[model samples]
Target: MDVKQVSVADKARRWIFSVHFCTPIIIIISPRLQILILAFLAASVSACKMNRCYNESELSEAVERKLRSHYHQPPDPLPAADPDSPSSCPVELYQYLAPHEENRRSLSPWRYVLRSMKDHFPSTYSEAECLCSGCILIQDVPGKGRVPVENFSYTSVPIIQSRVFLRRDLCGDGGKYRLTPVSQDVAVGCTCARPMST
Candidate 1:
């Protein structure tokens, strides 16, 4: 063969060998790249799962603490009811009070107080036979007769006590109750005592 022809043929052979040799290396590396990508994806998924699990546990713990606190029995010797006071709301009621705009959709103060009393002090509540009276006004209504004030305050009285026995039992030492706001972000109160005023 001519020298030029021979040189051209040698060049083609080298090119073919280079391609043949490099092809397998590329092919081999592809699977390793895929494996690395898959490993990264799996790790990300596991991390997300772990985060969700942690959040759920935290939520459960918060709920459990709240339930325990709500149901726990109060310390002995309920506060004495002031005879002269026209309003006698449970201290717990203060916890329910917040900015009016935030609490517009919430349960009425009267309802919350009744529910708390029933749940926490069932025996005393049942025995006391408390009847939930509606809002009491300072003056008498034309047809509704004079509204007798049970609890009086500068703000609205959220609770009332009746002269007639609604429940015949005493509440015992479990009567002292306080309202605790759940979220610092939101203005809220429980049906217990007024913390701010006190």
Candidate 2:
């Protein structure tokens, strides 16, 4: 594209870049605009610090350690994190700000949007339960499973949903499998584990 073909979007980009080199324009702007700018800055800063929610390395290590302790043997040194795994879970900034939140009251409005999108799109997870024995991780039998739809008009359907909870495993025997059907409440999920791997 030639410079003569520059569109309004390009012009706006040029204007923004040119003004960014200037002094704090928010100071000269109206109070509402200044508050908006400050709120944005605060949100950005808060997002950068959201990793304090829970250290995955530490938490995963702890879970693994728990598994080892249950096995009645001193476990070896921690294994390296799966290098092929996806990036860590992204959480809102407010969840960790308070030491003891009652019922997810601190979440901002955007979290709802994120959650809705997550549900509507695609996801994979394993349900688990903590009984007197140990944590039981129950997952679907591996397949490219798809949802059966009665309505032909609806094109989008969920894929890979396990109808039976037959696969059961004690949490830390490196995916110890009992292969007995069961039910569970808590679901541990991520976009990383492959359909076959889980």
Candidate 3:
């Protein structure tokens, strides 16, 4: 087996010379052209370095930076509801400190574990969930008999869709990991309203 080593300067030169400016003809290139080529090479090398995402260590550093930023800043306050239209069933919400905190426990028997699994990429995923999922007002209504229930209202929880950043591997792009948005459902709040049958 043969392994070839590539230096940064050699790679930069290869990238710069691969441009259309290089030709087989032995013509004297102008000083301006030489300057342009050098500038292009520097720009390409810098951009490549900036865009490189090689390993999990980089991901860890990025996630830590984002978490620091998230913790340092205060979260936005929830909007106040109008006094006239106050809801009887209020929803209590809490934020998760880690990614997929809701699904950390495995309930199924056929759970497959990956030895190399790591933390999720950082995202603007500060959405909350409802603490209660049962209807308070509907508890008085009898389940067996069709009692004439007056002023009976059902509390419905409102669900919202939020995007979270997940790591993805690009097969053709040297197996680099990139962050992509994945849709997740979040329960924002609950509202009390009259049922359709009422």
Best by TM-score: 3
lDDT of 3 by residue, 105-191 (tens): 111001111112233443333333332333333124466453222223443344454533444454356655554334445434334
Query: What would the TM-scores of all predictions be?
Result: 0.16, 0.19, 0.33
User: How much does candidate 3 score in TM-score?
Assistant: 0.33
RMSD (Cα, Å) for all candidates, in order, is: 20.4, 23.7, 16.2
TM-score (C-alpha, index-matched) for candidate 1: 0.16
Query: Candidate 1 lDDT, tens digit per residue, 102-197?
Result: 222122233211112332212232112112222222456588665433233323323332211111122234432232222111112222232247
The lowest-lDDT stretch of 10 consecutive residues in candidate 2 is: 108-117
Error of 2 at 107 (Å): 39
Better model by lDDT, 2 or 3? Answer: 3
Q: How many clashes in each candidate?
A: 26, 2, 0
Give the number of colliding residue pairs in candidate 3: 0
Give stretches of model 2 more than 4 Å off: 1-27, 52-198
Which stretches of candidate 1 lie above 4 Å from their native place? 1-107, 110-140, 143-198
Indicate the worst ten consecutive residues by lDDT in candidate 1: 181-190
